[model samples]
Target: MRKILVLSVSAGAGHVRAAQALVAAATGLHDVEVVHCDVLDFVPAAFRKLYAELYLDLVGRHPHLWAYLYDKADRAPREAWFSRMRRAVERLNTRALHEEVARQGADAIVCTHFLPAELLARRIAHGEAVPPVWVQVTDYDVHRLWVQPGMRGYLVAGDETAFRLRELLPDTPRIAVTGIPVLPPFAQRHDRAACAAELGIDPQRTTVLVMTGGAGIGSGAAMVERLLAIDGDFQIVALAGRNEALLAAYHRLAAAQPQRLWPLGFTTTVERVMACADIAVTKPGGLSISECLAVGLPMVLIAPIPGQEERNASHLLEQGAALLALDATALEYRIRRLLADPALRAGLRQRCLAIRRPAAARQALDQVLDADAAR
Candidate 1:
């Protein structure tokens, strides 16, 4: 059996989720041994905490500032002074990752996040004979941070993203325009009425699923309130991902309007919940977007975190798969519009299905294994 190491960083849940999806596909092959890990798991506690949580802190507390920082970081050349310093610091904190890579001795390595890819690429450049590494871009956009040396291949969300990757890493051996890999469940079908009944919701009513991001990062309570204000026979499912406080807030809202507001906490089975809804109102995180697309669910994106997410919104909009809601007024207007127009809803759904590649995980795994076999 050929062993495949799937690595990610927990800077955001998307990267780790993408890695898990790949592992899910790889596990079906009896001849492949898949090892999944978060690079942060092997680092010192403080560094891990800072590396993992800092992005959330910045995006949540100061999004505009985060956008500025995101653009600033993207502008720096990989070989520049600060870029070298950041890489040096990452190396210092992840001494054990080098050891871990040496120990794995796998036929192939896959990284859904850029951090480990950076380290692994450096090792290959230094003549460490690291296994062939493939880096998958988790978003529709590719930031400069994802440009790493010595990678064997690049997997990206679309042809546009693949073009971006090519511009950044011109000498890469291969670039595959694979959609972001999502869990198998997203690609599977579910009974809408049965799912709604299971969630204690009225199956006949129009349903709107509002995704408070996996990390509880979205336009939060205010957005929920705006959706509620729309005059329609509709209900909302609010997903408050690991945020206990948000869950509490959701529960309180449900208490006052139990029939209309349904609160959902963090869950591994989001696909089932998604089946219960007619449309999704989300922040347009890459994984969330991919899941919606896979399910052929229409989307109304609200308050995308600037940079990659902003680009993701633009991509969906250009593809005619989703609508962008900037604030409470736009949010209310869009939901109301979707509810009123079946033709519009059908059009959006068709567009979503048109862009979805539900078998991305399996396809990506097959390609990697085929390449490994060739070598």
Candidate 2:
């Protein structure tokens, strides 16, 4: 069996989710062994903790600063001194990563996050016989950090992103517009009436699913309150992922309105809940949006973090699959409009169906396996 290593980081759930999706796809193929590696495990515990926490802090508390830094890095030249320094530090810190790769005897390296790709690219540049690297960009937009020259192929979310990659890395090879990889469950077709019955949701009422990714970082309670206040015959399914306090709060809110509200904590049944939903109100994280698209659920995107999330929101809006809710007022207005107008909701759902790539994970797996076959 050919061993394939998928590298990911936990700065956010999207990267790791993408990696897992690829693993699921690859596992179903013949003569392949897939390994999932959390790249942070190779580094010191302190560095790993800091890396994850720092991202949360910046995105949650200091988003504008994060946006500024993201833009500055994007504008910096690939070979600039800062870029070189950043790559050098990553290469040094990921010595264990290289060792792990050799020990696993990986035939190819697939990276969902950019850090591993950068480290591997540097090793390849220095004449190391590193395995071919395939980068699966987990966001709808590509940051400069993801642009490395030695990559075997680049997998992106859509044609617009492919166009952006061509403009940014004119000489890069084999950019595939594979859409973002989502889990098999999300990719499967689901019956609305059956799913609603399974979840104990009302089939006649419009169901709106609200989420804030796995971390439960967004305004779930506020959004739920706004949605409930609207005068409509709709039900709210609020998922507070891993946020116990938020879950408890939602439970309290559901107590008063049990018929119309359902509160959920961290759940493995997200795909099922999504299947029962008429629409989703969520942050514009790549994985969340991809899963929503897979279900052909129209979206009401909440305030995305100013960098990658902003880019993701823009892409979805441009595709006519989602409407943006910039604030509490906007969220209420958008929800009311969708609830009031079945034609508009149907239009958005059709657009989502048109753009959905349920087989993205399988397609990405083919890209990896085909590269090995060519060699």
Candidate 3:
């Protein structure tokens, strides 16, 4: 059996989601022993928890501030202070990561986030590594941190990103644009109308699905309240993710407006929800963006985190697959505008269909394994 170690962190749900999808895809093809490794956990537990808390605080409570920091990080010279930040983090936990990798006897390593990628890079550089390493760029944009000479291959989410990577490392033959890895359910799920019927939504009416990232970390309450105030004909289904407090808040809000809002707690059926909905309103996390593309669901992006999410949102906007709302007020206006204009919505949906990369997971795994075989 081939032992595959998929490393991810919980800073944001997108990384873990993408890693899980890769595990699902790779296991389907071979006698694969898939393991989820949280590289951040190699550090002290308190430090790991602090990073998680800091991410949520920055994204949910101080988005504009986070955006400003993100801009600075983005604008920083490649391989400068930003790279130093990563190197510092790697230094703190590199020994633990090296021990874990050696202990697992990983035949191959797939990194769904930059932390693990950077960890493996440092370890390999220091002669503390084993196995062939593949870095999956979960975002549409490439961060220099994900680039490492020791990596056997880089699985990019799209062709545009592949172009960008080529500009950075022109001589590398290990780059492949295999699309963004998404759960197998997205590739296998079918029948939007039937899916809608199952959800008790009117199949004929335009249905909008709103989700915060995987953890349901967006302003669902305000958006739902405004949408209900405007219209009730089109159904609104909001997934609140794992935030029990937010779920309870939505349930309380839905109690008075039962006919319009279908507020769901954490669920594994987002693929079905995306299939049934006419469009999705969400933060532009990489996994969510790829899932939308797979099902041809256009997006109204709101409040993406700085750093990687900003890049993901920009990519979608540039491709005409999504509309970005800078704030809650702008979000309301954009959603209303799209809902009112059938032609505009149709155009966005068409663009989404054109850019959809449904075979990403299978293609990425195939290329990674092929490279290992060649070696």
Q: What is the per-residue lDDT of model 3 for residues 1-375, given as tens digits with 9 covering 90 to 100?
A: 777788988887888888888878875555667777877767787778777888788877787787777767655665687668757865775578768888999789888887777666766778864688888888999876566667878899888888888877645758899988888888876887888777877778788888863222335686677777876468788888887877887788789987677888777888887877887888888888999988888898877777778899999989999998877677778878888898998999899989988888778888877776787
Per-residue alpha-carbon lDDT of model 1 for 263-316, expressed as tens digits?
Answer: 988888899888888899888899999999999999998788989999999999
Residue pairs clashing in model 1 are none
Q: What local lDDT score does residue 176 receive in model 3, on the 0 to 100 scale?
A: 90
Candidate 2 structure quality by residue, lDDT tens digits, 188-292: 877888978876889889998988632223457766876788887899988888999889888888998878898888888789888888889888999999999
After superposition of all CA atoms, the RMSD between model 1 and the true structure is 1.8
lDDT-better candidate, 1 vs 3: 1
Per-prediction TM-score, please? Answer: 0.96, 0.96, 0.90
- Clashes (backbone N, CA, C under 3 Å), per candidate, total 0, 0, 0
lDDT of 2 at 290: 93
Model 3 worst lDDT run, 10 consecutive residues: 212-221
**Superposition error at 45 for model 3 (Å):** 0.7
